[model samples]
Target: MSTGRARRALWRWLPPWALDAGLVALAVLDAWINLYDEGTPLIWSCVALGSAALFLRRRFPLTVFLLTLPMTLFMDVAVAPITALYTLAASTRNRPLLAGCVLLNAAASTLAWPLSDGFAGDQTWTLIQFVYTLATATAPVLFGQLVQARHDVALQLVEVEEAREHERALHAQTVLARERAQLAREMHDVVSHQVSLIAVQAGALQVAAKDPDAREAARTIRTLSVNTLDELRHMVTLLRASGGKETELTPQPTLADLQQLIANSGIETTLTGGLPPGISTTAQRTVYRTVQEALTNVRKHAPGARAEVRLWHDAQHFGVTVTNTAPTRPSVALPSARHGLIGLGERAELLDGTLTAEPTPQGGYRTELRAPTRPA
Candidate 1:
């Protein structure tokens, strides 16, 4: 097996033209050795035509084999006829035509060139010679057919591999769709119900509270809970639609919603600057999320802090910066997975952008997002 592979590798390194030239040289040498003695002008001419015809064997195998037959009848030259017959056998699928070609080659080799010389032979000896030549001619044909079968099997294996890969991809997509549907059901049935209760309870507290501070805090809690429910509903809708069915989705937040977001944040925030008019919807959403996450973090970690949201854009880039003052009061620690900034960073990377979050020298915190104006 290793030796056959090495031989095939070597053959592949040789160019097609070089292989054809080598075959032509081998056929010419065979004709020269056979017809060296008993050489006439007519016989030499036949040898020249037969040897040259081998160059076109791959393109016109049957014609080249017929050209070599004339020389075979006049002289004992095997290389040209055998090579031509093998090429024809490998190229054609017609078994009857291949058998006819084998018979013609054998007849040409068995009979003498002149009609009188062939007739003068002993009939039994002539029949024996024909049988031997017929058997010899079939060797190249059988080998050629074997090579052709190996090539066909290699192509079939490649097609089978591609089909398996396609099936695997389809299976993965089906599994992902099923998981998304299950998640949508849980969010709608569990999370939405709890947040709705929180909103209702806060509204009732705001109506009944006698102290102004207590009433104001209850109103803020009610507003935040309602906003959370709206976002949760949108997420559930998207997850359920992951199966590729067209469903109307709630309009996503954009730059126009930035002011309302800051107002309802329950933190003192200032908004300034603006983005260009033609920016894509995806970029707008990225900017909105940046400010939203930054403000939420300030509220959680920097209690009683004032935040400033600045949106800026030039010819090349556009982004938002949310800076917060140091907290006036200590904050209550909240459970967090710390995946918010990581998700924001990934989102920015998808649009060829960057996100930076760090503490300021004066004990404040800053979060900024920068993205290309025209994403590829």
Candidate 2:
């Protein structure tokens, strides 16, 4: 992999033990400097012990502090690096633990001041040495703290970016699902009505060959087939280039399109209720398809039965109900229950709506679609 990617992978897999080992090495170096080169072995040994205790900073911060405090007192003042003390400070994320550790470090460092007379020869020299040593020792600790803070910031940035990516993915999925639903509705509107017209006109031509009506039936079938091809072509164009220039596609049909649907049903269709102006495109398109499917099924299954199409909409919900009068005698060839209603069900579900199909008590089939106005 690339260097940056490999480095990130390595950092993620890095074990805590490795970090402890590195900290221990720093402590050992400081300890050796104190014990081998510093003034007295007793005081230097104490400093070595205290600095060595820093290796336990992550696992047992309290224990590390308790063990180090006494050695810090005996050590020549401020012999240990401030980084070791900073590690102790960093281990305690709690404010109270940090406050207590700072107070203890300051008190211990001050208490050891009497052991160092190198500063007593001159007040200015002593003060300068103390200030320089304190600053130098604390520098590594402050640097480590800053590094830890930056690490925390980087982690938070990663979390936010991950959340944004997840949200974008979810949104894309939702859009795709809705588009599929719209495609199903479009296919249902195109195929069912066109196929039904072909069936009706072809059947009429069989019985009326001697009359001009048979020729008209033939013409109507040709017209419907052409229309079906045109609609299919429009859909194919959209799919080919993902929706070409706007003029190539027709405007999405709405309630206004229902008149042509009812007229083309051939069966007497009585539309009773009004639709709301504020109905959403999803709800409107769903209603249109539900009505079309219901009417197409009525033509296939009930043949000559009268159909009643009702649509009512208010501020909260849009509802559609299509019911047909029962046939005088049940046809042995009622349309098989394979296609239309199932597609409607999926469309309704996408909008958090519902579709129900059942036999009316009066003997005809009834299909109802209920869609809410508000998006969930």
Candidate 3:
């Protein structure tokens, strides 16, 4: 049990308190070995003063060095405590102070060797003795400086890793947002074209039931259905192609496409105002989707009801309002994800714009979106 206790104590890294206690123990042992045989209280008192100085070594290093300087005159090995001065200088990151302390300890130890009692060496042997003493005394402080430099390097590496992780997370979020926007554009293109053809064919079929003068209109409906299916198949092919071919070098729909959208829906459209040229592509795409969704909802949910898409623009602002009237009792139920309005809200916020959707006073839905013409 005693051996195990000794092993555990030796294996542990010493805390500041433990290291200070060790320094005090070493000081006591040195005083007992070096001054007791001389039988003088003055030499013992100097050892006591030097040992007590260890308590303030971390707080005031220069003061500790000064107090230990007088001890070199009495004992040949008395300058050993000045090594702690260099250790403190390294810990505090004071390069000039550490170098000064090293030089002072070397000079004092060399001068005291020849003057002390029982000294019989010439200058050559004395010089050799002083160089060995200086190197041994300075080793602990050099080791301490190396430890401090390694610790600083480790902290810098941790900071760099954290910064890299933050950048990677930001890049992932940006890629996800771009993918979602691309999906929204593709969905708008596919659904809008198919539903437009269906509405046009149904409207033409209704008008041609009683007239012999309507064969051309019937043929137009059939042609539209076939063309819509062909376009849909081509869209599917585009989706499976390598390298996002659907997105690259393809003509994007803009405000000009709104008239085509309305004509294909069999809804008569009137243009009163022009859209601003300075609007960003993202905002224009969002505006196009909002108009497209609103018209599709009118056709599916209010079969005979007409829709009005109004775009109003000024110098610094633009606005869009899509409204439809109440349909008959036999109106069809529209398929909806209910996420359109929320998605519109998010898109408007990205452009620093605003959107509002509410029930119209005439018993239908009205969606209004507004944005700045210039980047804000």
TM of each candidate vs. truth: 0.57, 0.43, 0.47
CA lDDT of every candidate: 0.83, 0.65, 0.64
Error of 3 at 365 (Å): 49
TM-score of candidate 1 versus the correct structure, residues matched by position: 0.57
Residues 1-376, model 3: lDDT tens digits? 9999988787575677677767767766765776668736776676677677776777776777766655544565443365466556556677777767766776665665235532555878767867876786577668768877777667556545543553454345345545655664675476756666675775677576676547656666767766776666555433322111135368766677877877887554444555777776666766886787677556555656766888888877787888887764235233344544555676677567899887788987788889887762
Q: Which pairs clash in model 2? A: none
Q: Can you write out model 1's per-residue Cα lDDT over 266-348, one digit (the tens) per residue?
A: 89999999988888766787788788778878876786889999999999999899999999855544445555675567557
Ten-residue stretch with the least lDDT total in model 3: 237-246
lDDT of 2 by residue, 1-376 (tens): 5999999888879886786666656655655655465557665565566667766666766676666666555553343335455665554445565555555665554445465654357767656655655555455456656767776677556545654554454355345545654675666677656666775767567567776876777767766776776766556434322211122256755788999989997889999998777766656777887897788677656746899999887787878999998974334342233445656776677567899999988888999998787742
Q: How accurate is candidate 1 locally (lDDT)?
A: 0.83
Taking the candidates one at a time, how many backbone clashes does each contain? 0, 0, 0
State candidate 2's TM-score: 0.43
Backbone clashes, candidate 2: 0
Clashing pairs in 3: none
In angstroms, give how far residue 315 of model 2 lies from its true place. Answer: 32
